[model samples]
Target chain A: MTTSPPLLPLQLSDVVFEAGGKRLIKDLNCRFEAGPPSVIIGPNGAGKSLFLKLCHGMLAPMQGQVTWNDPDAVSARLNQAMVFQRPVMLRRSVSANIHYPLKLRKVGKAERVRRTEEALALAGLGRLRDHPARVLSFGEQQKLAVARAWALKPQVLFLDEPTASLDPAATHAVEELIRAIHAQGAKIIMTTHDLSQAKRIADEILFLFRGRLLERAPAAQFFEQPQNDLAQAFVKGELLWWKLGKANRKRRD
Target chain B: MDDFGDAIRAALNLLVSLDADLMEIVGLSLYVSLVAIFFACLIGLPLGAAIALFKFPGRKLFAVILNALMGLPPVVVGLIVYLLLSRSGPFGVFGLLYTPTAMIIAQVILVTPIIAALTRQVIEDLWLEYRDQLLSLGANTTTALPTLLWDGRFSLITAVLAGFGRASAEVGAVMIVGGNIDHVTRVMTTAIALEVSKGDLALALGLGIILLSLSVSVNGAVYAIKDAAQRRHA
Candidate 1:
């Protein structure tokens, strides 16, 4: 077995992304090492999803670089995968969907089958393997999407609100799936607005406000005594609005 | 009214008897149209996908031009192909003028733009939803094209059917290029034209009825298959 070089620590420096004539993701700098899950938590329009897109190489950074420890483009690409807020099933059976990225990476047939089975078992989707992926219920489809990404055995997995639309039961199931995936050694980088969910799954927290990373800390430290006032209000369960930035700064002055 | 009744009666009798000339004409028409549609798909699917997926300069204008070509008048297409395949023309050495191949060439030209334009619409819509994911999965435009084409297959089938409809129903291109020769290049549309011009109303109407029915059955069969498959997968 030829083991590829590690793709971490993923480092982004002075990264910016613009769309619709607006700088949606401002100049940002960060580094993610090979470790536990890193959860990016912020309100709407904070550019959390855009940050993930840049990190995953789905969108090019307008100003700076998103670099990985591995320099080879093919290996760096094959070693990362992502799941969206609403999973897009390939209009195929569940098993076929799991096999897709593996096929894209050109995994050997024998290894592909083994990894596919591992993913199905990981998500408890074994019985529904032959069912059409799009025909599955929403939660089941999300599971299939995560499992499909997992089949590549990527070094890093970026999930954009993997449980955003799911019910409590389904959310629990997915949370468990994430932990299981983490246990298997892939770095998890995800974004969510759900506070309790961040508490449940996040090993580290990166907080963004208005397209900028305002604060980042280990999960426990973030929830307990957050460094930034906005983050403090967020941790204290205070309702945050766009106007809150000035109001909070005035109080500080 | 009497002529109409007689024409309907003639159409039924000819259909029931399966006259040798009638069978030959029907077979040739189906052959030429089907072959033209096949070639059109081979060219159109990829061309449409590339136009949808790539961002080359003048791509939007290229798309507009392709859509405009879908409305090309069949007689003009026939005239152009006729010019190209005439003895004095570039491809004249092949001696393909007035043959079934000439008819196919003209019909392919007529149908390709229609298929390609409609396929572009279908694939473009699908690419909107699929682009980010496929790119995240490390698919470049070349790799994403086939995946988008396959995933858009059921929709693309409708595009092909529309092209086939245009190919099988048109008369001007085949009439101009094939010359409507008996037992040589006589397709249903061209034959109906010849019969009408010769004052053989019954045979013309008979061929018309058969042509209309053929169109309906082909469409019905494709829709049935597409519906069942969509239900299973959707």
Candidate 2:
């Protein structure tokens, strides 16, 4: 991985995204700098994934702006990577999947091969490097997806519910990988519905509800003394998705 | 029953003796169809990938047209090529009419749509899955085109095979263009037709057996290789 310039101080201002005549992300404003991992805890349909997509430039917000401190948007994009919840492995061997993005970036063959080997060893996928990536277990596929992103040596890595479908062992493996990535100096912005997972790794926490950022605080402070009522309810596990939906239905009709 | 037994015996004799005439026809048939397939793939793979990757106006219309062309009658294609290469037609100056080249052109016309349509399907499905990922990895549709096509190579092989199958089996197009000329463009299907018409039942049946075996052998060999490669890289 090459030492690229920092793409930090990422800011989103009044970022509004609508779909099918409904607003998925409201006018949301936030700023993230080079720091510890920031875990976004939210209920389903709270636009956590969409938010990540906007930040990664996978999507364009209908309004407002998602801007990096770097003026060159193209280079900024090249320096950030995202991993989705359901990993889509290319129809090739495991090592090839890691090699794909580097190839896309036109990384030289020697560097590409060296990084691919390093990623394989780091993910403990050295043995299955020749095996078809699509044939791997779901957990392993996610790991490969992460390793593939990490090989890019991005300054920022956004993961949207990457371990949502994994078992406990897989979840633990993914957490360890996230911590390792953070240690490598990439700011990690991830979303999780699992509160326990949030507690395990979040240095800072942001509570999202109904497309709005209701609260943002350091992890310990956010958990122990939530400033917002909804955040308090969410941290306490008192606000189930159905209860939120029932309240929404009452307000709608 | 006696005639059928004689035909079988004659066929075996032709095979064992390595009949020069039989080999010539077989060689011509393989040459024309394989060349046609080569051209078909050259035109079809990229056309299909474009249709799958880009969102231009008339895309759906083009998809429908390509799909409809897949079922086009070989005779109609032959007639079209025949007129195009006829003395009074635009391409007549090239004098391609009734030549092996004319036959190859007709087969290419007949096979391109099949390859393109199948390639479109394979590439479209892959694009749906890889669209976001590829875009994030700093690729636009243009750069992603080759990647999608390469990833879908295993399935694309089936498309090429389907084109080869169509070309090898169809007699109507080649017959019209090649004119079944002895030692010129005489291929397996046309020879069978000519032999059967001339009441040479043994030679006709022999040709038929060879053609059938040839089709089966090519398909069997391709399927074996395709299956093994797909499994290894699946």
The residue ranges of model 2 lying beyond 4 angstroms of the native Cα positions read A1-5, A239-253, B1-10, B86-95
TM-score of chain B of each: 0.98, 0.95
Q: How good is model 2 by TM-score?
A: 0.92
**Largest DockQ belongs to which candidate?**
1
Tell me the tens digit of each residue's lDDT in model 2 across B164-187.
Answer: 999999899999988999999899
lDDT of 1 by residue, A1-253 (tens): 9867899999999998999899988889999999999999988889999999899988898898999999987889889999999878998889988888788778899998999999999999999999988899999999888898888888899999999989999999888888888898999999998999999999999999888999999999999888888888777766654357568889889
TM-score for all models, in order of appearance: 0.96, 0.92
Which 10 successive residues of model 1 chain A have the least lDDT summed? A237-246
Chain B of candidate 1 versus the native chain B: what TM-score? 0.98
**Comparing to the true complex, what docking class would candidate 1 get?**
medium
Indicate the worst ten consecutive residues by lDDT in candidate 2 chain A.
A239-248
Q: Which clashing pairs does model 1 show?
A: none
